[model samples]
Target: MHIYSSHVLVCSGTSCTSKKSPELIKKLEEGIKRKKLDEKIQVITTSCFGLCAEGPIVVVYPEGAIYSNVTLNDIDEIINEHLVKGRIVKRLLSGNNEGNNSYESADFFKKQVRIALRNCGVINPEIIEEYIAYDGYQALGKVLTTMTPEQVIDKVLDSGLRGRGGAGFPTGRKWLFAANAKGDKKYVCCNADEGDPGAFMDRSILEGDPHSIIEAMAIAAYGIGSDQGYIYVRAEYPIAVKRLNIAIDQAKELGLLGDKIFGTDFSFNLELRLGAGAFVCGEETALMTSIEGKRGEPRPRPPFPANKGLFQKPTILNNVETLSNIPIIILKGADWFKTIGTKKSPGTKVFAIGGKINNTGLVEIPMGTTLREVIYDIGGGIPNGKKFKAAQTGGPSGGCIPTEHLDVPIEYDTLIELGSMMGSGGLIIMDEDNCMVDIAKFFLEFSVDESCGKCPPCRIGTKRMYGILKRITEGKGEEGDIETLEELAETIQAAALCGLGKTSPNPVLSTLRYFRHEYEEHIVNKKCSAGVCKELLDYIIIPNDCMGCTKCIKVCPTKAITGKIKEPHIIDQEECIKCGACLEACPFGAIIRK
Candidate 1:
């Protein structure tokens, strides 16, 4: 085996790739070669470190010094000082410390418990050997050789691991249902079609540790007595798709997949099916429908996917995050898995944290971790000293969590009780400046656009709700608009055909429940206190504060402000467009948004 004195791990995930980590890799390799240290040093590409905001990241091993925001110019110093001289570059190091910074030492990583993201930022994903060295396929081998099919299912049931794909369904129960359902041919499937806004948990797993998913699927197939499987992922995730295809080819070459694994009687084959970027395909039945080469639309449930799915065969569908945990559970025993998280909700959850927070990245914490910790401890609180107002979880199909509920534990049942849900783990923080009514309108608009038009509740009901929200934000809201929205939300939640339709009104309903005053203010008082609704705002020149600065007048597109150079300006309200251009142009805090 080849041994290196030192290794440099560069982040190659989509976030880091976009920030030129690939180019940084090329430069590092060239620099290492130029310095005649190529033999002693190894340069490898890994996936996200979860601290996406700190990319492009480079971690030097043996010492494990993380270098954040790396550029092409920083390569020479890293190769020379760290690789050759054995001196850590303090200037390029991640974290606020002047001394040492490693994986466990970093603040952002302190609260996180990486299970699904364990291999990410650690192993070179494209290389199958790297994954193998870390005991990648050991779980599959164990399941195939040691454990019986029923035992495997029973172990999962004992683990208390719920599905990480937002619905929080029992993973073992789903597998058992598929196993018990009498079918001549049963199929195992992985749902990598993550369509939530600002959510990339599935994509990261696919990119960083594709082999894990393959191993788990094989284990599941063995348990369920299935010989064929399919993975439905969006084509938009080109990196993930490429890595997954590579992993599959590698597994087949090693006899881990395809005919008779480990020379046993079991035989399983896998295939990939790409979606056309349909958000509704995230639903189980819709995903199966899409996989069958049909339009991605939800089918009403009498027979769930376990009984009749994937071309009318008994099938079990698990999302990428859920499947990633299976191999670990098999290898590390159910008891060990159950010890990590809350009793009801065992194991950790990966959250894609974004918007208004200081640290915008991906975080995986235990299920019962409070919103306060996620926002303050891990996320570094809201940016620019702004007070945190609300947090929106579960994307468009979920609800908003106001400041009052910041202390609430972020479990599935707890979130549901608070009128929100654990929808695919997209946590968007909002500051004091955010208008809750506007935020609700934003999510409703997304639902309106993504709706498949399959049922009236989602098709027409969500559209009507969106129109009402739009009117409220634009200063055209009627007095009874809030009541109408509430009525519509109730109807949609009750009568919608599928999960997507039923949950489409969640954002609107939750916002109204917690921030009803914001809506009433927008409608009754014709004002936006947060200064977000431009149509409801009237920018006024504070006469005493205005020092006759013509900056506002010069920058105004509408030419609404007019004044002599030495005198306070007068804004022509009739001509003003509420574009906030004058507000921004004002230097002395003279223009106030009301």
Candidate 2:
């Protein structure tokens, strides 16, 4: 093992990499080499530190200094001043004040209890040695050498860990079924094909701690008596895929993944299968079908994956986050793991928070944390003092959480009771500027576009619902439009072919359930209270605020405003395009929308 005087960890996750963290890392490495301090100081390019809004993040150990928004220019200063002179770069440090500058003390990271994201920003993901140094494969080693197959399953079952991939099925029960099933071969499949928008929890884990997933999968294979496994990942996640392949190769070379792991008779082998970015494939059967070289579409249940899956073999499938927990549970015992979360739904959940939020990044908190805490304390609330209207969770398939339900605890059962499900943890915050009708339309359109078209309810029913939402948003809604949408949403939910279809109407249903007043306003009053439907709005010049500046008149696309140089302006409502250009260009604060 190599030790250094200082270890500078730079975030290299997708968010940070997109923001030129790579360049900063290269600069830091070159600077360290140039200064002849390679032996004393080491630079490690790791994964996301979770505070994406402040990326690219740099955390220097010894003092545990965290710096955000780092640049190549800042790298030289960091190396010279912080490394050589033993001085901290106060200017580049994160947090509102110097007291909470590091990630450990920062509010964003303090609220988070990272289990799946444990090694993300802490280790060099590209290197297997760093992962092993952190007790990475110890669980696998313990399971192979000490525990029996049924004992491993019993331990997992007692841990009370559930699937983190939307559905909260008991992990132990699923493993037991797969193990008990009579088949020549049983396979373990990892659902790394995370398709939800704003959801990158799995991707970050793969990029940062691929070894965790590998170790967990190996443990699962031992428990289920499966000698082969497959990880189904999306092609869009280039960083995750690259790191996973590296981890696999490294583990095989280290005699961890290949035949006779730890010199036992268990010869478990794992392979990678890339997905085509299909939203439907997030479902287990659909994912298995895609891995079998078929089009990704849902198959009817009852002969579930446990009985017949992936080339007609018995299979146990779990997502990246779910698998990541297995190693810890095995290492730390089920009682300790169960003590962290709720009685029914134990363990932590990782969410990818985005949309109108101050803290836009990945966060993993205990299962029972309320929405208020996650949105306000952890997310830093909405940006620019915007009023938070609602938050959309579970991607297009999940419902929106209104202000009335802010204190609701975020468990699978509670979320489902609130007309939402914890679907892969995509929590998108919406402010007052966002229209509920428009929000429904946006998600409905996404569902319509991404629909596999395997069934009529989701294929045509969702289209009809989207059409009604589109009409309402365009100010063409009729008296019966709301009733029609509600009816269609119910029908789709009850009659759709798969979970994707059944849940596709969630956005519309949830919006109507909570913000039906908005729908009524659009349908009856022929007005968009949020001023979102352009056709329903009319521009007017406020007589009191107008100063005859003629700014609105000059910039109006249709010349809607007319006035002399020193008098109040008059807007020609007939010619107004409702582009809000007059409102934007008015220096007198006169132009208003009615």
Model number with the top TM-score: 1
Question: In model 1, which residue pairs have backbone atoms overlapping below 3 Å?
Answer: none
TM-score of each: 0.84, 0.83
Per-residue lDDT of model 1, residues 412-433, tens digit only: 8999999999988899989989
Query: What range of 10 consecutive residues in model 2 has the weakest lDDT sum?
Result: 95-104
lDDT of 2 at 261: 89
Cα RMSD to the true fold for all candidates: 12.4, 12.5
The deviation in Å at residue 446 for candidate 1 is 1.0
Q: What is the C-alpha local distance difference test score of each model?
A: 0.91, 0.90
User: Per-residue lDDT of 286-310 in model 2, one digit per residue for the tens?
Assistant: 8999999999998888798899998
Per-residue error (Å), model 1, residue 451: 0.9
